[model samples]
Target: MAFLPTTREEMLQQGYEQVDFVYVSGDAYVDHPSFGCAIITRVLQAYGYSCAILAQPDWHNDDEFTQFGEPRLGFLVSAGNIDSMVNHYSVNKRRRDKDYYSDEGVMGKRPDRPTIVYTQILKRLYPHKPVMIGGIEASLRRLSHYDYWDDKVRRSILMDSQADLLMYGMGENTIVEVADALASGLEAKDICYIRGTVWKTKSIEYVSDYIMLPSYEEVCKDKRTYAKSFHIQHENIDAIAAKVLVEPYDGWYVVQNQPPLPLTQEEMDFTYSLPYERTYHPKYKYIPAIEEVQFSIVSNRGCFGSCAFCAITHHQGRVISTRSKESIVEEAKRITEMPNFKGYIHDVGGPTANFSREACDKQREFGACKSRECLFPKPCNNLIVDHSRYLDILRAVRELPRVKKVFIRSGIRYDYLMYDKNDEFFDELVQHHISGQLKVAPEHISAEVLDKMGKPRKELYLKFVEKFKQKNEQFHKDQYIVPYLMSSHPGCDLNGAIELACYLKKIHHTPKQVQDFYPTPGTPATCMYYTGLDPKTMKPVYVARTHEEKAMQRALMQFTYPQNYDLVYKALKTAGRMDLVGNGPKCLIPYQKPGHFPSRRDQGKRYGQKPYAKKGNERKGMKKR
Candidate 1:
């Protein structure tokens, strides 16, 4: 299949006078299933709607926004695959030097908060046209969210963008429904009842079976109220059990309907089977982001491992959805046929590689337990920990012609793998899938921090490490395990940092880089960071808020660096850990020489010199002595 029309010429060539929908994106046009824009547009095309691409329009002026003209149906806007703020800035709020999604890896292709900016431009250019926003930037910010960059509780994107509608989460079903409704002569405001969407209204009288959340004013003023509102939003994410949620702001209400139902196997297959060019437009020399996923196949979606820092549960839901084996193999065969086909397939996994099925049987019928987690502290007894189907799919793909090796780069939940009674999949994974080092995220070593982060205890990770080593030894392979660690998370202090350092020292592993816990929007960790309390329990939690304190904690994780010597020394001293300030093997840093320089304790005792002596006077006094 040919690439979609990205310009008016192409649109005319496709035998269309006016397109049905013009999809505006923050990232450069890449027709890959991994991209949300591609999937949503293709789904619409499958339903016989003409869609044109407006990838990374120049946001400074209204001219670029009118390139595609007004579409017959509406405008679908997305802030690329990632949030614009995250793409443009680093966790430290520094402007990023490069953007992988842009052509030739250039930065500033799209403005910060592209969804709002683009929609505002569209509304200005064509006042009567309906504008809708989706993708990660809009999905996670669909409701009142804590904006880390702004350092304030901000209203929903719907309020800021003034778009008629906002579709959150995987928007295939929702977008199609929206298009069909609009194509059938329904105004955007009149089509507000679709699931997996957020729409604004002047009143809540029309909303039924809905829960009224704390208003935007309440959430902004009170952290406890925000937590309560977030909790309600969290609980109502499931399609089977969720109810409409209404949040009021300045006499207007933003209503979030229940999430769409999880896609069945056939539905997943159909979506993946859509004709994707599987590469970026030829206009650009290359897109760095496509390199990471061109050879990768996403066999599944959603994650059951609900880590506190992760937003998968909020966006993808907890239920696992898988594509058919035939569909996966066909895609692999197609990959082998590509001109740049190498003997290797980069990855065959999704959010959590091993999660091929729902966490338990009851999850499909009643939705995931709101208060409890599927894999945290310990695996639920009702969890159906199996990977046979996944193993079969991998084996089939590996046997295909021209396929040399298949790797699982997407993270595998080590805790879930450890819970399975059968070790067949584990053995195969170690034997064939691993690429030199298997990376697992054991975020912290302190049990207190782990519990607060909703991660398993340190012992579980250790056991997994032991098992991984044994398996490598059994297979006679010299493979290693790389544990991803984090610092300065809630419930972690100077002592916890010291504890993690000690653990790393015990293992004789010095990580080159440490991840400072970034408190992004719509995650439990972010909530804790902003409120200093766990939303799950509403109990007070310790948070490292100061820059110096956070820096010290991060430096301790990599204490071997020469530049970190002073920070480590100060941190140890401040924590009254003078025992760790010597030249001993266990000491993090060496003590400074006594009387080596002017100090508080050695001010007047240095060679019996006067305290106020100038440099020349000190030298003369030394000569006289």
Candidate 2:
């Protein structure tokens, strides 16, 4: 149970302090104020919508958290960085399974029961109050999904979360739009006609047409692939236009990515013209709306990398867009003026922080192929890569003092960093901007996978790692690389897994943790996971999403004992990775008796397919298996 209560009555009973709409995520070096669920709560309160904002609402207890002060307005959800679609479940389960569907967090072991993160308490206390679900989690779940993590297709999230409605896409604009719509004498059923909304009604249901986006699965493998498929230059309308009927389950149609309307120079300038001190102190709150940790300004939107497993191209499209430096600087000044203001600016970056000017490889007179690598189908010849201007803005930020520190914590593209190795300012960024450790997504190590994903050569990753490792050593502090590794991307199979494990051994360091592949709501990889064939190449690849397969890929990343030993041993045996079994740098796979292994999971259990256990982990003296 959560330390906090899940019920509205429980919340009202307790004399809690003022409810906070936006709070900081408790991760170290992650001080940015979250903009999802909490942000909406703040906005609602300001408009006299009568809601409470609880920062980092305890997931363990929904009752207490929901009960606090004001009358209940529906709950809005967004997990940040990760779209709610994939973040709903544990990493491995959410990403790899095809048959996997999202639920409203776990209710009980009715066996195969569906649940959401905070539905129980909401159901228990506010049964009469409306609870609207939105953000990536609900948006992706609005329709049936082919979860790569589970290896089989699953039902839509709407059917599972049991919330009144769901609003998708970046909800900053949508949440206010939705709240205002609901507050104005509009019925929930009729609200479906609103753009970027999902709701239900009697007799007939309504769902606004989904902007044709690429498959979520493909983005998991490489965002560039998604970009190639749907971006304007490649503009493969047939693939994106191909309809996957929602009749089997009613809600919304499959993703349909429209042409990316690149923000014009004037529009970019206009965004810069908006008030940068983006703070919202609702009427219900006692304090100001701004937070100390996260004073953020989006420098640019969308990506030029067009990785196979990303959705930027499918959603925001390929052409990069930006806000002016003056607007961002002014916002920083406004934040500084707050009574509670501290000389701290957590982050000032966006989707691939390095690319300031839009278009990948922007310098060439003759354009590259016009395929959408980030989407699906294909990338275009007109792809451009431009990052020169972004570097200047970052330097300008460094000179600003009221802003104590500027962070590029939003997952940097090392490929961009490598292009201009001599850019001294970038090296400074590596030293100052990083919060002890820099996180870069070197998604995979295989050449084949890299090419398919439209990523730079694997050699480039090696070169950058070597260069950065040297730089970090020179810096003489704890600053190191927090590499993001993805298992079971579109082109990855046993070979890819083995290769990754071997690379870890060669690097002489083991990853403290890792993430498994998640096909998300709208990406190309989901289709490949479902059909076991990459749409682009029509190549057959074994989708390793079974509990055993997922475990095999995971074991190489850690030294967790017994629970992981069996899986690791099997993975090594299957991959012909016997050398890892003996006492070597990366050897965790030595043969051991079943119960002697060390892992968070029990013996014979694997992630995504852990067998039914009668008791919870907290239960004392209970036998595991």
Candidate 3:
């Protein structure tokens, strides 16, 4: 009904002498289900526990740590919704100008690696109290893994933060189990049997039947050993099929239990139905984080589409956990009642919007296959391709009173949509869901790059595009696909970048923004980025690590931009791809005169548009902007 206590006065106002947990967050408090901090605190409260929020406390002052006094149980720490290093810096390791999660989109509201920093501060102030770290930052770094910002292998966060326990993955189940244990007077060190947690131990006498990973020293000294360790971690991400994994570190051992089971439909519904303020704390001037999610609904959790660049598979697991259609409709009703409601629902999807059900029947009972993926390389033969339920959910929300439209704003798995024999979902998606454009991620057109990225082949994307155009025509609507593209990913060289540029030139669409591969922890692609070897196959992979090469790769994705012409030209020349630099229709750019640069006029000429002609929002095939 109200936001959790954020100060001692608020804590007293709630009539709590001592709270059960003090939730420390790197982000300004936004009590929405979209944020991990809000969900954890709200879940604890729903389970008859009192909790307080310590949002972005100044790390320098000891008074900030003692503001709420001490919790009855312990402290729960998270580095906001994203990793702090990632939130603070771009892929080029440049400091970002803004932090959307902070008030007024300010920067420097929190320190780098705040999960470790905050927990360390908490430990220094309250050394005896347990400090548990979670969120994307802690979850991905729960073991000995590569730290891109540090450019070296770092120990588990539990070891660095000196936190008694670390929770990985979606922590609804894990948090509650740990809370009960703590309230019952069990020490943090004694509570290790719970799933979805990483704990440190000095002896293996109590640990049994666990996979022993290469020692931390070995992985640090050898990239090949690190790749091998990453492969072991990747295979054990499944909940039902994974075994406990132990990594030795000198005199101590870090043990990671198998991931928690995916939430069932009922549990997911209950979690979302918690009493949430659904906005940032009232005292802040403005919180930029609310704009995207205030009117949206999270219809599901978890992703089965295991893209190599994505950390969702490792953090949320490969199992799909979706809410019931009724639950989604209820949330849609809530959105319509908000004062700022514009009769338009911004989103009604999660990790992969169209992944509204389990990939196969055996997954829920037996977990996903350890060695294979559901839709990469090829769709599993046992994969179930149906979207009727998701379509039905969309229809119900669309037909609700005061709701003019409902959009699936999240990433849609085009390959999954194309695989469905029934076109009902696809038809309705084009006709009803799209707000003039639908965003899909093809990532790249190069076969080797796509294979390395664990994405389906370009043929699948081309087919999906053809079908999308047909559906738009059939429905008599103008809709375009906004393909999300990435550059400088491992296994991508100058030739591969040129190949993608040619494909974009052939399609007559240039993305306004292109993501340079960010080597964040826990992703298979990051493993390749750090080790220059594929963990899955142990094959050597090409990595563009230099600033100039990364810039060229990114420029190739936006090759038509006047600003990127020099970089694109350099990339073409470097790749010995001068054949694509001529004044031909297929050439990405015209041959340059010494000191002469192409303008928007030349770009239009290449697209066969008249100079100074107005390029309106034309939904022909897939115009990305």
Q: Looking at model 1, which ten-residue stretch has the lowest summed lDDT?
A: 616-625
Tell me the tens digit of each residue's lDDT in model 1 across 69-122: 889999999999998898988778899999999999999899899999999999
Task: Give candidate 3's TM-score.
Answer: 0.95
Model 2 TM-score (2 dp): 0.61
Residue-wise C-alpha lDDT for candidate 3, range 438-534, written one tens digit per residue: 8999999999999999999999999999989998888899889989999998999998998898899888999988899999999999999999999
lDDT per model, in order?
A: 0.89, 0.52, 0.91
lDDT of 3 at 216: 93
Using lDDT as the measure, the top candidate is: 3
Q: Report lDDT (Cα) of residue 349, candidate 2.
A: 77
Find the 10 residues in a row with the least total lDDT in model 3. 616-625
